[model samples]
Target: MDSGGTDIIWNQFILGAALTRAARRVLERDGEEGEEIRFSYADTHAGGGGLPVPALLPVARKALASSAWAAAVGAGDVHPGSWVLAGRLIAALGGLAFEADVNDLDPAAITAAKASREGGWVRFWSHDWFLFLRNRLAMEPRPHFVFIDPPPDDPRGPGYAMDAAILLDTLGLPYMVTYAVDTPGAQPQEAIDQIGRSGLELRGAGLERGVLLGGGAETVVLDILSDLRNLAEVLGGELSVRLPRAPADDYCI
Candidate 1:
């Protein structure tokens, strides 16, 4: 898949909307009233024409409306306000929102987002997400929610493994969710094994998207809740996993 491939996947998977809805349900179940919520999205390829951005906005807005403190921090080129609108809308429903994105966002898009006066609900930054999270987690309060949406990298590339490793190590932190597309070389099972070697267990796996055209276009949702639970047992913390309800037609070879 190329740079714009995520947009296609976004539409096929309905990820943004589904995740937002799931998050809202989780928050409500926890009775998390007006509490600060943090969301970190990696390698976000969202923009004016991006499918995930437009699809996610409404659901996010609804979540923001019901929460006390809700913030979203996206890495890469996602528009801040588009997401912030969701948070702000949610805040209006008796919640609060603080959204921001890394500075490496598209220049034109960033400018447009800035001019939208949606800054009140969001902030943008140009920094490396790994470094940012490492630093922030140390000084800032742990976020209730974290989303990792890395770009579609060659599965054989070291970058994918490195990023996965970092995520596994960082999983002990609050609630976290990540997205990965199905590719030949990028085996989710391999990633799970790697995490397990680090003493983490493989919780469960779910279906994110199914193939619409090609054989390898399917996306699998690997739930690491069991792994997180194992890690927490040794590390001392709480962890959980929630898989999206699988579509009846979602299947892989």
Candidate 2:
């Protein structure tokens, strides 16, 4: 997969779209109950606040210039990171209607995330992501959506843990879990097959630059994939929607 900030840009592009659709559904559902809905979001691998545009690779900078993401570029032309983008997106979609649990093992990342657009709604934590998820299992109100973007090359990383997906599925949570395809230690097919084995219908997109596997209620999955297709149209790139298939079948888009 592409390295440096290029990968981040592409990853956030899909994530932003996914969250937009998912968050809206949360509000709509809770609104029907006449109860105040404060949408909750959890990011397992929330990175730093932003990156200077000039510091990004040529391809990343090109993507920023050519897409709506340029609006995320800050005062110094810094591209906002995932957490910052999530905060901004949520704010625009539903003001003060959301709270986020953004965590990372890197102190620098946590520090940056806390500093970006300070607000009580965005909580920053320094902890192992797997432990974070385990703890969240007991949360009184589970997050409406979880975004998992684990380290791409670590063979023992939590992203490679199929049981994590099973756990989320059991909770009936909507999530977008990303994995890398062109990396040395990445097992893309195994991850897909494992999701099927979990008895969750396969709902994912094979992006030209990344791999995203998502699952949840049927309506939620359709919304996420619809946003992905819209992104493919805008970017003029191939975002192959991987439809549901039997477990152990050859994974294809």
lDDT of 1 by residue, 22-122 (tens): 34543565545557554332223223322233333333334333322223323224434334433443344343344444333356655654554443344
Candidate 2 TM-score versus the reference: 0.72
Model 2: lowest-lDDT 10 consecutive positions:
197-206
Regions of model 1 farther than 4 Å from truth: 1-89, 102-105, 116-120, 152-170, 173-187, 194-253
Model 1 compared with the native: what TM-score?
0.43
lDDT of candidate 1 vs native? 0.35
Best by TM-score: 2
The residue pairs in collision within model 2 are none
Give the poorly placed runs of model 2, Cα more than 4 Å off: 1-4, 32-36, 54-76, 118-120, 158-161, 182-185, 194-209, 217-253
Indicate the worst ten consecutive residues by lDDT in candidate 1. 211-220
- How many backbone clashes can be found in candidate 1? 13
Q: How close to the true structure is residue 123 of candidate 1, measured as C-alpha lDDT?
A: 49
